[model samples]
Target: MNMAVIGMIAGMALAFAGYFGGFGAFLLVAALGAVGFVVGRFLEGDLDIGDIFRARDDRRR
Candidate 1:
């Protein structure tokens, strides 16, 4: 399965968690989804750790 798709589905699962488990569960699931997304991006070579905190250097704006 595509990592992006899996991340989206995992994020959506928070809706069900909210419905049955409450706000805490929703938040936890949401966090997990975010972590999963980052991990997936890292694994897929789409995430650059340095870039996450790097200042924008673009001057074309």
Candidate 2:
């Protein structure tokens, strides 16, 4: 559930929107984004790992 994954999903949603149009596509994108964000947060917390921007290992050193 990385941001990159979410972005790719969002791109998919847009592609769907282009084909399907309107509310359903928007909702699908929203759901995908939310799910991705939650999964990303859960993984980060459970694994004690984080993105470089948030990890700040160098600062700690």
Candidate 3:
């Protein structure tokens, strides 16, 4: 669905995890959510694996 609804659902999930499962569970949910998001993007071809691993130029002054 839309981003707003997705965001709301994710928020609710985190809230439930925090309330019923504690901080560790909250963190676990958050981390898994992030991984899922990335995987989804990758699967959708919206993200390139090389983009994530490409090194940045840190020598720019």
Candidate 4:
């Protein structure tokens, strides 16, 4: 629950920064969010998100 809240705040920060023309802040938060998300998945023993999401072109019998 705490992580969820923090994630929400980070997302808001990214958006808020973008609105105020703080591109660096926006990118920083986005990078943090991306890294944190990927790390969380790693801790959970999940593979890359791209691997989790199968492409339509790769769908075959």
Candidate 5:
């Protein structure tokens, strides 16, 4: 499915979850979804482990 369709479906699911399961369940689902996205990106070679925690560098004189 296209991104828009997928997004609509996900939005509906989240709304149902929030309505039926309340705020905690909504946050749980969101967190799990974020984890899944990260893992999928890693598997797709679009993300690296260090990318999550790596700090930026800056030099000043």
Candidate 6:
């Protein structure tokens, strides 16, 4: 799916959490979504662990 669809789904999820589960659930879902996104990117090889840890000046040119 495209970014728009993904965003819509995420919004819907947050809305549901906020409506039924309250603020804490909304935050939990949002945080988990972010972690899921990062894990997905890492598994897809689109994210490099070292890139996140390395100093800015140490990055490849």
Which 10 successive residues of model 4 have the least lDDT summed? 52-61
Candidate 3 residue-wise lDDT, 1-61, digit = tens: 9999999999999999999999999999999999999999999999999778866763232
Candidate 6, superposed: residue stretches over 4 Å from native: none
Scored by lDDT, model 6 comes in at: 0.96
Compose the digit string of candidate 4's lDDT tens values, residues 4-39.
898788878889988886888788778888888788
Predicted structure with the largest TM-score when compared to the true one = 3
Candidate 1 shows a clash count of 0
TM-score of 4: 0.52
Per-residue accuracy of model 1 over 2-61 as CA lDDT, tens digit each:
979875777679878999999999999888877977887988999888767776884234
For each candidate, what TM-score against the reference? 0.69, 0.42, 0.92, 0.52, 0.79, 0.89
Clashing pairs in 1: none
Clashing pairs in 5: none
lDDT at residue 31 of model 2 (Cα atoms)? 78
Among all candidates shown, the one with the greatest lDDT:
6
lDDT of each: 0.82, 0.70, 0.95, 0.80, 0.82, 0.96
Cα-based RMSD of candidate 2? 6.6
By TM-score, the better pick of 2 and 6 is 6
lDDT of 4 at 24: 88
Error of 1 at 44 (Å): 0.8
Indicate the worst ten consecutive residues by lDDT in candidate 3. Answer: 52-61
Candidate numbers, best TM-score first, in rank order = 3, 6, 5, 1, 4, 2
Candidate 3 overall Cα lDDT vs. reference? Answer: 0.95
